[model samples]
Target: MAVYTHVPAEVLDALLTRYAVGTLVSAKGIAEGVENSNYLVETTKGRFILTLYEKRVAAADLPFFMALLDHLSAAGCPVPRAIPARDGTQIQTVAGRPACLIEFLSGVSPTTPTAAQAGAAGAALARMHLALADFTGARPNSLGIAGWHQLAANCGDALDRIAPGLGGRVADELAWLDAHWPAALPQSVIHADLFPDNVLMLGDAVTGVIDFYFACTEVRAWDLAVAHAAWCFDPGGTRFDPALSAAMIGGYEAALPLSDAERAALPALARGACLRFLLTRAWDWLNTPADALVTRKDPLAFLNRLDAYAGGGLL
Candidate 1:
């Protein structure tokens, strides 16, 4: 349903000629993603995900994403590998968009994650960080503070339409983050978006960490903060689960202990993470076309998280 471009059958068949992945049997549009058109592609050899990078994804960044996936997969992290074409390039053009076939990984994304699942996800995240510690690739987080400011400006008065006083609250939060955000902490390639949907789990073990489009080089613990904002609360952000939070941190620490500075910066980082989502969701709410296939996420869900993070102690 999130498909933005429809790839015709003949075009798909022609594209399959570049890969030795066997002739395409079927290709069904995947409904779960927002930024790219994805398909559950079946071939004579095996099943794979064919992603046609949409407008939001920059063509220049494709190589960085491919390299990151290759690095993580080779490091034994539970991530999908970008299947190279017979020409040895992972990137190609399909439906007039940059595309790649990814090795299919098995598992379901938990709808309502248990503490054990949260713990497993946290450990998997830490492993990804550790594995990418030596990766030479670098990409800036475009949705960082500067991008948040741009979104706030783009939203303008619409923020109040979403919820009263949201614009003011976002402005205040941005100023606070600019002053307080951690600067000297350890840095690495991080999966900036690690929501429940991005992680695929089998029971309590993580089978895959998919959707690395938002991946970037940033403070390592801020990645933990992003996960904390995403996984430690109920879907509506109405209830906090201290046990789940503790378990997540415990699992992460078990894999790679957090530094003292990282520990000290968690609260602010969590607040920044919350604001990042709140701003983006607000922008999307106001801008997405009425007939768009993707669901319009309620920006207020993260506004609740921003408020909770402001109160302190949730982390």
Candidate 2:
């Protein structure tokens, strides 16, 4: 989603030689996200995505991601599968970073998603949870509660530089979540970061759910909570959309119903979701190079959501 390392045309052509994909005609750097270097590559055969893993994505986690894609694809979930090279390897070296050629799915990431789109996304998320029920791989979430504390410490008092009073609020929320987070919930492999940009939609149908880099084993309802926080908000995170929330939850329940305990624990789970993004965005906002190809996201967007969730009117 971002290009930190630049790959030349000749190097890309040579890399494609290891695969049956074809000659590279053009490759453009996608500079939207902060985690990896991505390009939309066109070859004689077809169009595909070229990703060079950069910050945050560990090389050790590549196989787990590839396997998850393959599993989901085989299970008829709408996910992009990693295209293997002729040598039968999906992971290869591109610009000295671990890279992969992925199946290109066609659909635009909605900017202002409609209720129908939210419903479809929610259903797709549930389908993903059901499809992965048999997946044996397990990777603990590195950005979970403990990581939040580490990020806050790493940020220290500098968080207030982004916004007045932000540091104290983050610290207090971490402490409160530590005391109140659910002890036990149904856990599974989840796409922990299911923001609208990560989901590709065509009309009311979900054609692709991309960006599994943040995917990890966690509480199942927590995934829904993340989606709720991401989808049911205005761009500035100032207004709540009740219709979107109802449709999303309705769609999810149609596929996989939540347990009574899960229902009761959603508000807290949602607060955790808000803090997770707030801390990470604050970390990225402070640490990412100013000259980097990616745009720094504002951390306060989720702060607004955190404040809203704390008001106790929402689910």
Q: Which residue pairs in candidate 1 collide?
A: none
lDDT of each: 0.90, 0.94
Best by lDDT: 2
Residues 59-131 of candidate 2 have per-residue lDDT tens digits of: 9999999999999999999999999888799999888999999999999999999999999999999999999
Task: Write the residue-wise lDDT of candidate 1 on 1-315 in tens digits.
Answer: 167788988888898899999998998987665688888889899999989898778999999999999999999998998898898989998878999989999999999889999999989998999899899999998998999999999899989999999999999999999999997899988999999999998999899999999999888899999999999999888888998899899999999999899999999999999999998888878987776567778889898988998998786
Q: Which stretches of candidate 1 lie above 4 Å from their native place?
A: none
lDDT of 1: 0.90
Cα-based lDDT at residue 138, candidate 1: 97
Q: What is the TM-score (0 to 1) of candidate 2?
A: 0.99
